[model samples]
Target: MRCDRIEDLLPAYADSALDPRERAEVEVHLASCPACTSLLACLRAADEALAVFPEVDPGTELRGRLVSIAAPRQKFSLFTLLRKPSLQPVLTAASVLGVVASLYLLNPGRRDFEKNVVRTFHRGVGRVEKLYAQAGGITGSIGSFAENLYASLRSSNPLERDKD
Candidate 1:
């Protein structure tokens, strides 16, 4: 193996993680290349130093906080869905649909029902449009009023009046 390839495998060789064939190749390269040998020595020294460092236990409060952070979170499930009050509207809609399906299966008057639903949806959209228009008109009037007030103030200022 080349010096570069042996250098790349030095850390794994130090950790005893390399395969026997690769380790032998790296050993041969390291013996022939002083640079690769030094690099391997550095990696081994780092590993040994790390191994000798004493493990420190965290404080009780920090341990508690870490345990809380690392604890398995509550996963979303059907029971979680049932627990959420915000899902009441969804549940109600689902139940209503179930009832409608049963009724349609029995009576088969879904065309009229679909038409009514579409009409109601269109009415809601129209109301939303009217609200947006009203909001736009109000904003336009407020903006115009602010502009007029600013112009009048500018005109009434003694400095501005002198300039004019």
Candidate 2:
């Protein structure tokens, strides 16, 4: 085994966590390498020092206080919507869709709405033409009045005025 691999395995070897074959390999490397042997010695010394410290059990009251402090308190909140594991994808999709929809609606350079308005105006004109044709010469005065109304409405439209 390489020195570095042997060094890494030394801690686990000291802990007796390695299989017999791996432990034998590390032991062979350690016997040949002085640096790794010294490292293993230092690891053992630190482990022994740590083991000498007596374990102290906290009192019941102290344990209860510690548990209370460590535990997360549940509360009702909209921000908690993200805490649910299953709803993560749903929330992410909703956020993306909302941003996209807002951007499309709020974009200053978008002309699709203007095109729709123009289309509606043209359709209105066509409908008025049909009405005028159906009325024939009998409603000539009414046709002229309707034509004037249509012209006034078109002129007064904010979008048409903005174009001018």
Q: What Cα-based lDDT does every candidate model obtain?
A: 0.88, 0.90
For model 1 the local lDDT of residue 88 reads: 91
CA lDDT for candidate 1: 0.88
Candidate 1 is scored at a TM of 0.36
Stretches > 4 Å off in candidate 2: 54-164
Where in model 1 is the C-alpha error above 4 Å?
A: 1-100
Find the 10 residues in a row with the least total lDDT in model 1.
Answer: 1-10
lDDT of 2 by residue, 68-131 (tens): 9999888788777668899999989999999999998898867987788899999999999998
TM-score of candidate 2 to 2 decimals: 0.33
In angstroms, give how far residue 43 of model 1 lies from its true place: 94
